[model samples]
Target: MNKGLLFSCLLVAVTSVQAAPISIPYQGFFQRLKQVNKGNYPLVEIAFSVPNKSKCLIKSGTITTETESFPLTITQDQRIFLPYDARLKSDRALVNLDIKGSADNCNISMQVRAKNTKQSYSQKELLELQAEMNTMLSDMQGFPMRYFSQDIEGINFEFESGSQTSVKIDGQRQVFTDKLRLSQEQLNKLSVVEFDTKPLVISPWTHG
Candidate 1:
């Protein structure tokens, strides 16, 4: 599938849920971008608030490149992961979230450093990403897949629930809402979520 066409398809899908809250966690974007480039699966955690009250579940979806469309597998825990192909330029990659369930509106954000990152991309960062994509050598240019790393991480647009109801970043209480664009101040002060998934625990044992 043509990546352009695929993005178009996914963009259309985005519109259907445009009214819902969707955002990219700008603070930890660099780390997530690294993961994407390295072909690692970047997990997206979506939270929902139901004015009408409905449950949502994402079963499966596809990630497309110019030549191929990869399958995105969903775990029972509601984490969405994908085998991102390094050969493809993902700067403009679109994620078509296949959501099941209901709600008055769905809140979407990216999980960066185990904290929900707002989906707003910084203008400068966006420009830089575009430049990188423009400079990246493609498979068509005789570059091998491995050499064509630096996969662009796609912004997440869909989620369920978590223990952490809300978070504070940069000394500001951050709560995600249904909004497409964000301001410069918000982008500049975007918080880097500091939650750790695992912490070491000690058990007493006697050693001679």
Candidate 2:
């Protein structure tokens, strides 16, 4: 092959590899555990994300403390469930991800989520959870953005399928579905959030 052609081919190959996704190590304060330790939220989840075209799959993973290691499996949706563990609450933990296939094409990132317990929450408790979630969001934002950006505009709560869960915000009862979005306006007026059934997950929600 001509020297010029060979150089061009090499450049293209390098570019392709460089463009591939890479796994991201977890960082920031483990606020999910703090929320779980509060005892209101019983479940926490570490959710992973990968590009649709990426070949990165998490075969297995572990959350290890100084003395103990807990084996965990990622679900099809790329989620690892971590139920509230009193031991892990105070102990510092390290998360290790085991990626399947080539590391080059696999780009995995994670976000922590807090899940509601089976018991319904009263207005006071719901407001407390919302406040805690906002705090957690702030911690995750970090640095300049954390200082400049306003708190999350809304709250998105996900409920189990086929379950009838409802929340009354400011005396206005809203039924829950797969996803429920409470806008900033609604949240400002939120004095009462009464849930009939607990939600599966709670997250920050911003309108499109």
Candidate 3:
């Protein structure tokens, strides 16, 4: 099948789950895997979020390829990290999700992430990440829609417990323990960001 067609099929399958199992195509999975590999990330996660108002629960799941089957472990937060397997790059596979109730009641997404809780990043890398994140946010809230939408306020770096890190904002060294927030303007003005211990995760921070 054409790659585009396969992707379209996968989208349709994910969006219209009804009472049946969700089937993700090999092509889609491979594309995400390739992204992780290219970035040198340890794992890619498939996350399912069930709305608080919804009663649906995921019962079980498995990933099956042409040559192997692996049982999936769904976390308490309803996320499953795809196991890294070099063989998956060359094989056809499908991820099957079984829901106890209605699959349509849940939201599914995929994210690439680093494995380590602490890792160093250069100033150049931080700037690059800021630019990429800003571009993504702009694209998401572009043109007419941005006028009414409440976009994220800034980027936040979440550190592991008891970890301390520091970054220079406008020539002043600011230290943080649990979390650090950097505005887009601050990120642009940043010259040196020093970390005693690297952050565990970097995410968008939205105002409440």
Candidate 4:
């Protein structure tokens, strides 16, 4: 979604939580541990939130797999999410987003996997949607963020509340512990819930 559209949606669904200065290299979405090694997992999807009142040029970008890395095509002022797939081993991968005219470079390491579910719902189902996620999270304790890095998902529902939680499930049936840290205003304008659990690795700009 475009920044204007997303901001409009946020305004329509205004909450008590106020906005704060969040850094870039934001991981809007990524793979969850339990589903990473699954047969259908996606390679990667990259997204970011630019600083308010400021924009940066995407000087260069690249995705590095186990033993190889390739350049990515990104345009100036392109802020929406993009999908990336090297089709190499996805057990571990690295992404680098070098912003022009800025010192901060966004780097991320994550597991890529196909999504387990993707669905849409009406605005009336917002409460139900959250409730369902809470239930699933309760069963698994909570989902985990990337190790040695920031949250793989940029949107922190509990940043202000500071009651963040994370959990991971392994294929070997092992449970691992990890830690880390949305909105409505414009609900009326929203036509669908747009739920996607598939962790797609987005390429900056591609025609396919």
What are the Cα lDDT values of the candidates?
Answer: 0.32, 0.50, 0.53, 0.30
User: Tens digits of per-residue lDDT for model 4 on 1-208?
Assistant: 2221211122111122222211222122233223322332132221333332143445566655557666655434333333433243243454455554433322222211112323334555533443333232232222332112111222112111223233221111222222111243333345443422221221111011
| Candidate 3's TM-score | 0.50
Tens-digit lDDT track for model 2 on 1-208? 2111211121111112433232222222244344334444334333444433336566677877779777866676666555455556567665565665565555444444555454344545555555665555444343212233355555667777577666665567767567777776765665656667666666655323
Q: Candidate 3, overall lDDT? A: 0.53
Task: Please give the RMSD of candidate 1 to the true structure.
Answer: 16.2
Per-model TM-score, in order, reads 0.30, 0.49, 0.50, 0.31
Clashes of 1: 9
Which is the winner by lDDT between candidate 1 and candidate 3? Answer: 3
Model 4: worst 10 consecutive residues (lDDT sum): 199-208
Residue 5: error of model 2 in Å? 42
Looking at model 2, report the run of 10 residues with the lowest lDDT sum: 6-15
Rank order (by lDDT, best first): 3, 2, 1, 4
- Give model 2's TM-score versus the native structure: 0.49
After superposition, the stretches of candidate 2 with alpha carbons farther than 4 Å from their true spots are 1-57, 62-70, 73-77, 81-107, 140-147, 160-177, 188-197
Tell me the lDDT of candidate 4.
Answer: 0.30
Q: State the lDDT at 127 in candidate 2.
A: 56
Q: Per the 3 Å backbone cut-off, how many clashing residue pairs does candidate 3 have?
A: 0
In angstroms, the error of model 4 at 29 is 7.9
Candidate 1 pairs with clashing backbones: 21-178, 23-119, 24-118, 24-119, 24-120, 25-117, 25-118, 37-151, 46-159
